[model samples]
Target: MRHRRSIDLMPREDAADDGATLELLPEWYVLVAKCGKCRHQGRIDRRLVANRRGWGVSLNSIGPALKCVRCGNREGNKLLLGRLPRD
Candidate 1:
Protein backbone atom coordinates (compact mmCIF):
# COMPACT_ATOMS: atom_id res chain seq x y z
CA MET A 1 0.00 0.00 0.00
CA ARG A 2 1.13 3.50 -0.87
CA HIS A 3 0.55 6.46 1.42
CA ARG A 4 -0.17 9.92 0.03
CA ARG A 5 1.36 13.04 1.56
CA SER A 6 -0.85 16.06 2.06
CA ILE A 7 0.27 19.45 0.80
CA ASP A 8 -0.92 22.89 1.83
CA LEU A 9 -1.83 25.51 -0.75
CA MET A 10 -2.78 29.08 0.13
CA PRO A 11 -3.04 32.40 -1.63
CA ARG A 12 -1.25 35.29 0.01
CA GLU A 13 -2.80 38.78 -0.03
CA ASP A 14 -0.83 41.45 -1.87
CA ALA A 15 0.03 44.51 0.23
CA ALA A 16 1.74 46.59 -2.42
CA ASP A 17 0.28 49.85 -1.19
CA ASP A 18 -1.01 49.78 2.39
CA GLY A 19 -1.38 53.49 3.11
CA ALA A 20 2.36 53.79 3.59
CA THR A 21 4.18 57.03 2.95
CA LEU A 22 6.73 56.99 0.15
CA GLU A 23 9.87 59.07 0.34
CA LEU A 24 12.30 60.21 -2.32
CA LEU A 25 15.79 58.84 -1.86
CA PRO A 26 19.18 59.67 -3.29
CA GLU A 27 20.92 57.55 -5.95
CA TRP A 28 23.20 54.67 -5.10
CA TYR A 29 26.15 52.76 -6.60
CA VAL A 30 26.67 49.22 -7.83
CA LEU A 31 29.47 47.24 -6.24
CA VAL A 32 31.37 45.40 -8.94
CA ALA A 33 33.12 42.06 -8.53
CA LYS A 34 36.54 41.93 -10.13
CA CYS A 35 38.17 38.84 -11.61
CA GLY A 36 41.44 38.07 -9.86
CA LYS A 37 43.15 36.28 -12.70
CA CYS A 38 42.61 38.71 -15.57
CA ARG A 39 41.76 41.87 -13.60
CA HIS A 40 38.32 42.07 -15.17
CA GLN A 41 35.90 44.25 -13.26
CA GLY A 42 32.10 44.27 -13.29
CA ARG A 43 30.26 47.45 -12.48
CA ILE A 44 26.78 47.54 -10.92
CA ASP A 45 25.04 50.80 -10.10
CA ARG A 46 23.99 51.25 -6.46
CA ARG A 47 20.44 52.24 -7.39
CA LEU A 48 20.12 48.80 -8.94
CA VAL A 49 20.79 45.49 -7.15
CA ALA A 50 20.23 45.48 -3.39
CA ASN A 51 22.42 43.96 -0.63
CA ARG A 52 23.92 40.51 -0.97
CA ARG A 53 21.75 37.47 -0.18
CA GLY A 54 22.62 34.23 1.64
CA TRP A 55 26.30 33.06 1.73
CA GLY A 56 26.69 35.45 -1.19
CA VAL A 57 25.03 36.40 -4.42
CA SER A 58 26.15 34.88 -7.70
CA LEU A 59 27.40 36.99 -10.60
CA ASN A 60 25.12 35.40 -13.19
CA SER A 61 21.88 36.75 -11.67
CA ILE A 62 22.86 40.43 -11.45
CA GLY A 63 24.09 41.07 -14.93
CA PRO A 64 25.83 39.49 -17.91
CA ALA A 65 28.35 37.01 -16.49
CA LEU A 66 31.42 38.70 -17.93
CA LYS A 67 34.30 36.84 -19.44
CA CYS A 68 37.93 37.92 -19.13
CA VAL A 69 37.95 40.58 -21.82
CA ARG A 70 41.74 40.60 -21.73
CA CYS A 71 42.61 36.92 -21.18
CA GLY A 72 39.43 35.15 -22.29
CA ASN A 73 39.64 32.76 -19.31
CA ARG A 74 36.40 32.06 -17.42
CA GLU A 75 37.77 30.15 -14.44
CA GLY A 76 38.76 31.77 -11.15
CA ASN A 77 36.66 34.85 -11.79
CA LYS A 78 36.32 36.60 -8.39
CA LEU A 79 33.44 38.63 -7.02
CA LEU A 80 34.73 42.21 -6.69
CA LEU A 81 31.60 43.84 -5.29
CA GLY A 82 28.91 43.59 -2.58
CA ARG A 83 31.17 41.56 -0.30
CA LEU A 84 33.05 42.54 2.83
CA PRO A 85 36.83 42.75 2.86
CA ARG A 86 38.79 39.70 4.04
CA ASP A 87 40.33 40.00 7.48
Candidate 2:
Protein backbone atom coordinates (compact mmCIF):
# COMPACT_ATOMS: atom_id res chain seq x y z
CA MET A 1 0.00 0.00 0.00
CA ARG A 2 1.17 3.54 -0.78
CA HIS A 3 1.53 5.87 2.22
CA ARG A 4 1.95 9.60 2.54
CA ARG A 5 4.44 11.35 4.77
CA SER A 6 3.07 12.57 8.09
CA ILE A 7 2.97 16.30 8.65
CA ASP A 8 3.39 18.12 11.94
CA LEU A 9 0.46 20.30 12.91
CA MET A 10 0.82 24.00 13.56
CA PRO A 11 -0.35 25.83 16.63
CA ARG A 12 -4.13 26.25 16.39
CA GLU A 13 -4.94 28.55 19.36
CA ASP A 14 -2.14 31.10 19.29
CA ALA A 15 -4.08 34.30 20.01
CA ALA A 16 -3.67 37.68 21.70
CA ASP A 17 -5.93 36.67 24.55
CA ASP A 18 -4.34 33.33 25.53
CA GLY A 19 -1.34 31.08 24.86
CA ALA A 20 -1.27 27.81 22.96
CA THR A 21 -0.98 24.38 24.51
CA LEU A 22 1.65 21.72 23.66
CA GLU A 23 -0.84 19.70 21.59
CA LEU A 24 -1.18 22.71 19.30
CA LEU A 25 2.55 23.45 18.98
CA PRO A 26 4.80 22.07 16.27
CA GLU A 27 8.05 20.16 16.99
CA TRP A 28 10.30 22.83 15.46
CA TYR A 29 9.06 25.56 17.78
CA VAL A 30 10.97 24.90 20.99
CA LEU A 31 10.24 26.30 24.42
CA VAL A 32 12.69 28.89 25.87
CA ALA A 33 12.63 29.86 29.50
CA LYS A 34 14.20 32.80 31.33
CA CYS A 35 14.75 32.96 35.04
CA GLY A 36 13.21 36.03 36.65
CA LYS A 37 15.75 36.21 39.49
CA CYS A 38 19.11 35.56 37.84
CA ARG A 39 18.10 36.28 34.24
CA HIS A 40 19.45 32.91 33.20
CA GLN A 41 18.10 31.68 29.89
CA GLY A 42 17.56 28.03 29.05
CA ARG A 43 15.98 25.93 26.35
CA ILE A 44 13.53 23.22 27.31
CA ASP A 45 12.39 20.37 25.11
CA ARG A 46 8.65 20.11 24.56
CA ARG A 47 8.67 16.33 24.60
CA LEU A 48 10.21 16.20 28.08
CA VAL A 49 7.67 18.64 29.45
CA ALA A 50 4.72 16.93 27.83
CA ASN A 51 5.81 13.64 29.33
CA ARG A 52 5.81 15.07 32.86
CA ARG A 53 2.87 17.46 32.79
CA GLY A 54 0.88 16.07 29.90
CA TRP A 55 0.19 17.91 26.60
CA GLY A 56 -2.98 19.62 27.81
CA VAL A 57 -1.05 22.29 29.78
CA SER A 58 -0.93 25.81 28.37
CA LEU A 59 2.24 27.81 27.59
CA ASN A 60 1.36 30.46 30.16
CA SER A 61 0.82 27.86 32.82
CA ILE A 62 4.26 26.28 32.34
CA GLY A 63 6.07 29.30 33.80
CA PRO A 64 5.02 28.86 37.40
CA ALA A 65 5.73 25.17 37.26
CA LEU A 66 9.38 25.69 36.26
CA LYS A 67 12.33 26.15 38.59
CA CYS A 68 15.42 27.92 37.36
CA VAL A 69 18.20 25.45 36.67
CA ARG A 70 20.79 28.13 37.45
CA CYS A 71 19.63 30.12 40.46
CA GLY A 72 16.91 27.88 41.79
CA ASN A 73 14.27 30.52 41.33
CA ARG A 74 10.81 29.16 41.84
CA GLU A 75 8.51 31.89 40.55
CA GLY A 76 8.36 34.41 37.68
CA ASN A 77 10.15 32.30 35.11
CA LYS A 78 8.92 33.25 31.63
CA LEU A 79 8.36 30.78 28.83
CA LEU A 80 8.91 31.84 25.24
CA LEU A 81 8.58 29.90 22.01
CA GLY A 82 11.72 29.59 19.89
CA ARG A 83 11.83 28.25 16.36
CA LEU A 84 14.36 25.66 15.24
CA PRO A 85 16.00 25.41 11.84
CA ARG A 86 13.87 23.60 9.28
CA ASP A 87 16.85 22.69 7.14
Query: TM-scores for all candidates?
Result: 0.32, 0.75
> 1-87 in candidate 2: lDDT tens per residue?
222223232222233245568888777777888788998888888888999999998876787788999989988877766667689
Over 1-87, each residue of candidate 1 has an lDDT whose tens digit, in order, gives 222212121111122222211111112212464555766765544333333332233333333343555777666654333333335
Q: Report the poorest 10 consecutive residues by lDDT, candidate 2.
A: 4-13
Please give the TM-score that candidate 2 achieves against the real structure. Answer: 0.75
Minimum summed lDDT over a 10-residue window in model 1 is located at 5-14
Report lDDT per candidate: 0.37, 0.72
Clashing pairs in 2: none
